[model samples]
Target: MKKLYLLLVAVLAIGTATMAQSKKALQTAVIKTPTVQCDMCKKRIEAFLDKEDGVASAVVDYKRKTTKVSFYTDRTNIENIKTAIANVGYDADDVTANEETYNRLPKCCKKPEDGGGMKKQ
Candidate 1:
């Protein structure tokens, strides 16, 4: 019947649309940086990621000196996110901190090699 044919076509179209809309989800990398002695690092890192375009959420574990991020696959990617964090003076997995940004960290937040010697950055 024509009605059955139309319904089948509509269903196929919808299936295609749904598949196109479902962007691939990636289990992106985690970054571990020195969180130093307080909540400042956590606040700064989380706030930074919150404003980034692709980031869904960021969780900073101060005790472990690690940050776990969940992000969209389409709008942005891991490298861009890592660069954003590095721009703020924190080290992301693959991105190193710029000297200028690194030096700008608070005394307590400074990495061990920088002389503040609190811990790794």
Candidate 2:
């Protein structure tokens, strides 16, 4: 009985330690987007970032036109995060989305100059 109790305590301690080490917290940063006008834009940006390896969480504020992203610094950095956002047809910070990617956005998502009838950035 004594041996079993010690073994259980040891197992629990190890599990706790492993859990703590696996979870890395990072500071949050906000990225501004000029094309964030509606729910579709928010969903598209959030979904894309959520699939990235280093991103811990992403929240888009349409009214404020900013994305609050929490990412693991070891796995990714702010530049990568911004690039990922830009790849999905949204401008992040000072980096503009690639022209091809921006052109591929849905009609409503396309910027005004693209002839899709959306507002100009």
Candidate 3:
């Protein structure tokens, strides 16, 4: 009887604490990624964002040149997310690619003007 009583108290306390904490706002944004050239670009950007804080998911559609990102507003914002993409050597909407990081990317990942693109079969 005593154990049962204690368990009930603990559960109530935990519930109250959980209820008192407000839910974080989640937002989704689609950022244009015109410079993404192929599957490699998609994989690189998606993998990089997957480890970023507040980012829940990043879906890159290379063919369409867009990235849909779902993230927690309290933890991070759109600008930060764009910068993260730039850090991985790709352009994220108005956020241009980081020059140094862009230079380090493989030939296949560089912009077409820089001679990077899928070879014609």
Name the lDDT of candidate 1. 0.77
lDDT of 3: 0.92
Candidate 3: tens digits of C-alpha lDDT, residues 26-66: 78999999889889999999999999999999999988999
Q: Give the Å shift of residue 86 in candidate 1.
A: 0.6
Model 2 TM-score, 2 decimals: 0.74
**Model 1: per-residue lDDT, tens digit, 1-121?**
9999999999999998877775555345577765343577778788989999879888888678788898888888888888888887887775787669878889766666666644445
In terms of lDDT, which candidate is strongest?
3
lDDT of 2 by residue, 44-96 (tens): 99999999988999999877989999998878999999999999988899989
The estimated TM-scores of all candidates read 0.71, 0.74, 0.82
The alpha-carbon deviation from the true structure for residue 94 of candidate 2, after best TM-score superposition, in angstroms, is 1.2
- Alpha carbon deviation, residue 26, candidate 3 (Å): 0.9
Clashing pairs in 2: none
Q: Order of all candidates by lDDT, from best down to worst?
A: 3, 2, 1
